[model samples]
Target: MTGLRYVYAVCRPFDAPLQAQLTGVADDPPRLLPHGDLVAVVSHVPEADFSEEALRAHLENLDWLTATARAHQQVVDALTVVTTPLPLRLATVFRDDSGVRQMLEEREAAFRRTLDRLNGRVEWGVKVFVETERTEQAGSEPAQPAPKPASGRDYLRQRRRQSRTNEDLWSRAEEFASGLHTALAGRADDARLHAPQNPRLSGAAGRNVLNAAYLVSRDTSEEFVEMVDRTKDDAPGIRVELTGPWAAYSFAGDETGRGEADEERHGESGGESGEEKTGEES
Candidate 1:
């Protein structure tokens, strides 16, 4: 394959071979480029599409970005199964083999440090959605119409009551999320709380109150999963989600000099944000 080189991840050498038909971005099969003790996982892509000027235009298109991120993620996922991988930002491209080697050389120390920290660990994503009152009331009961407000004063009073109720629900949700994060953090080696996810992007119902990633050792992952399960039903109107055993993307740190647009790839699920498929898929 000939063109610009798209680098997917950096990791230590491993004996395990990638899946025979595993294809990366631009439909090119990935190859390992070893630099010192670190290996850069790279594949070729058309310069017309991957070059700096071309990428700036393509990234504006969501369809193109999503496809690229998914393909990039597939390579990272494969690496994760065999060994811990330090995932680079989406759309990381280089001019050629020498450029790729220079990157590995430049970032060697940082890569080794992050890889060592994430060696046997994986990332687990936890999200909590609070059910809205309208959602809860669906198909339950039809309430009698309230008498028309006697005056503007009464109308204002009614509005205040509704506002307070909404505030109370949100407060409760925040409190629950705080407690849950505390409990989960107790079990995880490290934890990060990202901004609440947008419902439009997540496609999950209700209000997203918690978007967090926890780093846990492989041996205790099962116990960590159970810990999340036990809290799923703890709050009446709160919903909990768990995704992972994925490569520690959230904990990998930004050694790649990733742009702001690239950072958007990690919305709620660390690396798989804005994706519809479950973590187990691909």
Candidate 2:
């Protein structure tokens, strides 16, 4: 029989029991696959139901995905409460237990190192959205401009002017992002700048200038949040949003063995580029 695959996470040995209590759908038990000191929280899926079309359907439905993800996260958080756990990428899967075992064997050292670095720490996300500048309305009567420039030189000058304006805006935004990152870095175990996303969807009244996540020790979570709050209060024209005290989802690299190398890589370079929420889609 072809068994279904479910990818969960790798955590310390002591975390397994608490994770089991909070995991899976309804009363269904989560499969705790252990390897040495590391444990993978998984569950069996039906092969026929996990085909390409089915997988696509599953991913496309936000409600289903969100519920499943929340359930999965509950377990990861439970584990985190007891021990440091590395969260795998969303939707990581394997054909069976053997596949998971092989992956653990292949990347054993890297996983160990990642765990070592992340031990006793958790991840938090903070996003800053810059309010869009309100455009000034021209007076009621259409303002007549000077005679149209007949020379190409004038047109080139106008183009250059616009280009400079665009460059200036981006430069200022980058500067702001950098400063915010620096401010928070002092209070965090690690800080990463994430790529910005669309303003409309990210619940921002204006443009999103900074999207970032920080990994901080559990004991320091409150202090880190306070620092972020202070930065938001001090900065004008920007609104910051914070989520997490969550499992180190953003910091968790590729614990799954399905060649998710690029997608699951973490640390300073692995986060979202801007307004995009890392690991939100999958």
Candidate 3:
């Protein structure tokens, strides 16, 4: 149970208040480590649990991972209330405060550039789903029936109709997804498209055609949300789901958490997303 520092976020110094009992990973309250004008939010973690080897095993446990992500988001949410936060990907750790300081110094310029770019802005998530509708329409006609064909003619025609309908829906879904991206991007400062999430992973069904994130300004967040809402009526069969005013997780420099060097340091895997940090640390 040797101690290690679990780093949460980096930002310029601020005097705003945090919750009296703000704890990060494993129920450890976070504290700040300052380097020049920058500060890193960090917490003490037990190496037995956070060490690279331990994280690799623990991250595979859904309950642990979910709880950890919740705790991480809790901290990020708190910071968002106070200042512009550049959140580190999940499970970002260094051996000690000195190591954290050195890393901060090394990344200081890049960090500042990102913080400046993201100032007065927050990240929002958008996901689009298309429900299954049983119907046929014009423009995508089914193949003509084979003239006096064999035994399964009726069944084959039915299957072909279903297949054509699916193809048509897919085509429409693509156009809708692209249009949503374009429309949303126009409203926000920047946008990114991620792979559509799986139903099992996202806990929703139909088809996830668009998984995207936008960096919207603080003053225009309502406008952004409203615009996302407005997009719903634009596509008849598609559902555009919006979630956020979140910290800029997608805009973080290394979208895949930290690089191999960090993982190699702890002999663990990197975080899958900024929201989910599960892995061992040094």
C-alpha lDDT of residue 272 in model 1: 39
Per-residue alpha-carbon lDDT of candidate 3 for residues 1-282, written as tens digits (9 for 90 to 100): 348998889988999878898888888898889999999999988888888778877767766776776787788889988999898877887898888898888888999899998898998888888765523423256545435535587778867877887777778988998888898899899997776666654457678788788989999999889888887866556677888787787787762263222222112333453334544333
Candidate 1 shows a clash count of: 0
For candidate 3, list the clashing residue pairs, or say none: 50-281, 51-280, 51-281, 52-280, 52-281, 55-279, 55-280, 90-277
TM per candidate comes to: 0.84, 0.68, 0.81
On a 0 to 100 scale, what is the lDDT of residue 217 in model 3? Answer: 96
Per TM-score, the best of the predicted structures is: 1
lDDT by residue (tens digit), candidate 2, 1-282: 345556567776773346335545332456678887777777765655454556556655656555655666666667677788777755666767887877677777888899999998888877766543421112345435445667999888866765675556556656777787887877788876656755444334666677777989988888888877777655444567777776666666555221122222221222222211122111
Error of 2 at 74 (Å): 3.2
Off by over 4 Å in 3: 133-152, 255-282
| Clashes in predicted model 3 | 8
Could you give candidate 1's per-residue lDDT for residues 144-166 as a string of tens digits?
55568999999999888768766
